[model samples]
Target chain A: MDHSGISVLFEGTNFERLLGGLWVTVKIAAVALIVGLILGIILGVLRTFKNRPLRVLLRLYLEFFRIVPTVVLLFLFYYILPRQLNFNLPGDQLATLVFALWVAAEMSDIVRGALISVPQHQRESGKAIGLNRYQLYRYVLIPQAISLEIPATINLATRVIKTTSLLMLISVMDVINIGQQIIEANNHTHPTGVFWVYGLIFLFYFLIDYPLSWWAKRLEKKRLERANG
Target chain B: MKKKSFTRIIAAVSVFAALLLVLTGCGNAKKSSSQSNNPSSVQQIKKNGTIRIAVFGDLPPYGWVNKDGKRVGYDVTLAHQVAKDLGVKVKFVQVNANNRVDALNSNKVDLVLANFTVTPERKQVIDFAKPYMKVSVGVVSPKNKAITKASQLKGKNLIVTKGTTAENYFTSKQPNVNLLKFDSKTQQFNALKNGRGVALADDNSYLYAWSKDNPSYTVGIKSIGPKSYISPAVKKGNKSLLNWTNKEINKLTKQRFFVKDYNTQLKPYFGKEVKPSDIVLPVK
Candidate 1:
């Protein structure tokens, strides 16, 4: 209703500040997703090992992270970790670490589900061709598992992007935090600013997440097509 | 079949657009109707038999929600007194520092008593009552890394609550300092305790109270920047309410109401080191 209030986002350094905040969010998400992917693959593969104690321990690790909320984990890592361990870490670094652990847990579950979903005959067929254990996994099982993992991983990446908004709570100058600052600074002059300020935040998040969602959908469709063909 | 599906999609989109327009139109209509009424005038508030005052719900000693879920703090008590003096029922709207002014401007509340510091920039948009309390920016840090002077803050990390005078002051005057701004008092203190910054700058009362509770930290710099007064703000051009509130503040000041407020609400938290006389504005 108040175009003037919304116009402030376009004026002066406000838009630039918002973009800087967005960059911070993107950087955090990107780092977390990459690190989590690597760690998750290891954990997922380890869980599939024949060692019973190791599998049980990995299961506990996954369940612990999956059960606790991200915000709680953030607080635990940011607040409790430093005092308990006598080591200081920046809030953004702590947030990324916590998010990565969370992603690792979720990704492990996705990988494990995909690995188990592969047909037993497929692995046997790879071995029938005289492929070694590692070669069988590389040439046969992993390729098939990757097709199953791609869409879910993209969906998880979107979740990481959405979760970066919580970084504002711990004083990380992410996009949502900067949006709050802009609204706080101008709200006195613009009474109707809450609507437009928050609306812009919604738009920024959608612009980022919507494409990821679309890509996930496209990947899923392609997987379906390949399966049919 | 393809044409029929295309027609269905078009019809669905049009219906969704119409629904969105109707919803937004209803919201605009309600806002306009409330604006037209303008029930913030003193006489109108009296006629309506109720006054809504916005105060911070998280900033302890100033305004906070008690464990019992009732609003109990210095500003809340003062707001209740104001309503009682006007023979009107009081409704307390909880607001954070960022949204307090907007709460008044948007007519969501008739008055804001959320430890709002009076400044020229804010004066352009909202009208402040006569000063009720005065406070200066103070700095707190770990005793081992105490910073007594402004010069020490150079290249040092300082934590400040966003939208506060401390943030604005350091941003303009001490641009070289790394200022970490948080949204609430709790987060600012958490950042300080978590070793996010070397010093935390905020209102003297808040820093004083916090340092008193946490022995590891001390108030290194007692004052920074010019003294600012905390006053209740009304929407700009609300002459009737502005005049009435100013008169009420003056009357209450003479009664030493703030002295009682300081003793009851703040003394327990800030300790005996913080004097009531030093912070409460003199009656004028």
Candidate 2:
């Protein structure tokens, strides 16, 4: 058993630090997802309106976030926001502010797609029942659109989880950051630790993400069965 | 149907992987962090009784967290001295080559002790106390294909951490040598180990420690360019903290504290190869 480099994890408190790192990742991801869900839902609903200026404004917002890479946005907020705001935001909070905004833009697009796909007859039926725009979304559009939105929304959860990795570059001490610290600490005797350490990180990400993906697949399967039946 | 699902999965995975093609300008920390003139940082630091010093968490023998999850290294030793001089506790904020300047300028830390090499451009944005260490750029390569001389790097990709003196030197002086820049020491060394480049360029001091750890490699190019110095830097013109740091450095230099720090924190890693006089600047 060539345990040479593998000891880096088992040695001292290194493994515990990696878990702390994961917890840090989870904290950031949780903030982003929860805030994103609220803001995204609101933005998504707003995007469905027929107002031209609002449409143009929302389209520009979506295009800007979509066209700009997420990592650049991460750096933008991590480094620039403090200067612009003249106050410090804790790293995760700052990241949440940027992420929630981006996710809301993405979510709005998703919401628009789902809402428009609810069939014109459904819209007509709602209008025939004297449902106003607010009532139509509250009573009719949102319920149906939800089923359509579930899988992609679940996919967003996984995306948000993976996105937390970029926080490593900004001194966030994410699992990847902790792993790099461990590797460098043991670089002398454990030169090969990178494989084991990164492999474990791969497992950590897979473990957290696989269940969400599995649930998404299951949701899609049930929808398919309902459609066929 | 199965193919559609696979492609959908691929698309979904990439949904966050980003449709990023050629990144446009986003954030340059050095440009904006100087906006705050945090003159009261010293007063706040003293009142709080804790001085925050930013350092590299993965660069060993300079600053790194040991297996105990404790921050330790040459830079850390200096940090302890700074905190002691101010009669305050130390809060270590880990920063990297890519973000060190911003860490200080943004007021995230009262001072930066991250083996920050003093440079002409950096002087424009941050205030350096006094230098305590001497450094020059060095290249390390796999023993099998060593890069002993600068000319040997003619067209080969050389790995360097972003914002380091090595990157500045190679890009400005050895332009023909393709530079593959990473954000941290760990990544550049990983790039070198993974064969991403022919060699890695860094402070020869760090290269010396790293090459000792990874036996298959050697600091083939021992030194490069002119000798530079490393110092504790604060926000641009934060005179209170800057002056306090200067007085502290002067006192430590007179007491030969860095030589003492060298014997305890650095000597074991450097062994017989580096003497206290070789790396210590005496901070006069």
Candidate 3:
């Protein structure tokens, strides 16, 4: 079998192409994660407020994102969103927007659950110290809630990174798009290039995601150790 | 407690409603405007340095990868020339048949060079340049026992790519035939190869390409329906780009570039079955 094609992947142009795609993946995931975290925290906090209206609204928002598939959401944003909304956003930006929506819903549920899991004693102590509800949250609640939130946030981060691969479906040309380009480029040389190309993509995705997941697991373990101590 | 909770819920609903309104505004600005422009706007072409041409990478003969690992085909060659004539570099993007019109309207690609046929229904979404390549639908089956006529497929399973003319024709013309739908040629071809379907229907040029290596399979029938010509597709209202492309194709046509293109890229499979004049039609 001719292995010369493999050399170009490591050498000049193909290497740059690969790196460019990886960068898009990173940028998409990072934006999604940051945006998702902020939105998640807000929703999570609202969900915990003992108000019936907030609870129902949060429930509806969470269910919409939770039940809808990310790929469908990506298409809805990329294709239908522009036509229906009368605004034209580029594909990459739209991918980020849709992914943020998905990540926010998932992350919010995690944040809500984790924040509630923090001891009721913490809230009681804040109230006893003449802390206003806002001050109690600012000084007493958020810091501890964050510790509980980190593992779930990290989990959401890993998911966003993986899910960004779906951006390829909407024409964002991330790592999977590069893989398809490589496969299409090599089809004349190899009849079954898609198999190898997609296999390599799986490897590329795993290389990025596996470490994040492992790191999250390690962080969780350390937090658990600290908590027990 | 209930009153405070009710106010917070209303706040949340209002925020979501505002977001929906913003999204709808964006969508309206980008939809349907692809339809009103006609082909005279050379100035607009000059402003855009890159011409986006959509091709179906999985579809062979028209646009596919060859043995050298480069995308080369009749449509790719034609697109390059069209871009060169417009004084812009060509950027080929893959789009499936169903999404080709949306890609044009959404500004994803400047024009679709995929094996797109001119159809009355599709005209509502995108504009068509003059015909640069003529096409006919055909069925492919095992060479040894290929189905030779429409009736031969009467009781047999026929695989067709979804949203293609093949699917459109077969469903209307041969309703009794067991029609299998796939989104890509890759799957349909595989299904045909594996005996899941007795034959596959698609553009004749593509069916010819698939039948080439699998001497086991042959394009058993030809010219199964009305003759249709392939054209470059553009956004609906961009008359300038459309006109420019038509003029360029006219020049290419006179030089027999499309004929040469067919021979170089398509002839290996078709072997002189295609006529040169049939490549580009009178500017209609």
Give the candidate number with the greatest TM-score: 2
Q: On a 0 to 1 TM-score scale, where does candidate 3 land against the true structure?
A: 0.76
Tens digit of per-residue lDDT, candidate 3, span B132-192: 8777888888877878899988888999999888898998988999998998988998888
Model 1: colliding residue pairs: none
Q: What is the lDDT of candidate 1?
A: 0.80
- How would you encode candidate 1's per-residue C-alpha lDDT over B23-123 as one tens digit per residue? 65566456545644555998889988999888765566777644234567889889999999999999876565666665566565789998988989999
User: Model 1: which docking level applies?
Assistant: incorrect
lDDT of 2 by residue, A1-229 (tens): 2567778888999899999999989888888888778767766776787668867987998898888888899777777756675556557777776788788788888988999999999999999988766678878999989889999998988998998888876777899999999988876767799888998999999999999999999999998898799
Runs in model 2 deviating more than 4 A are A1-3, B1-40, B137-203, B210-225
lDDT per residue for candidate 2 within B141-219, as digits (tens), equals: 9988888999999988999999888999998989899999999877887788789999999988887776766778888
After superposition, which runs of candidate 3 have C-alpha atoms over 4 Å from their true positions? Answer: A1-19, A46-60, A185-189, B1-43, B48-50, B57-61, B64-72, B88-93, B139-202, B215-222, B237-244, B263-284
Steric overlap count per candidate: 0, 1, 32
lDDT of 3 by residue, A33-102 (tens): 7877787777777688787986898799899999989877877777775555446667787787778778
Q: Lowest-scoring 10 consecutive residues by lDDT in candidate 2 chain B?
A: B19-28
Model 2's C-alpha root-mean-square deviation from the true structure amounts to 9.8
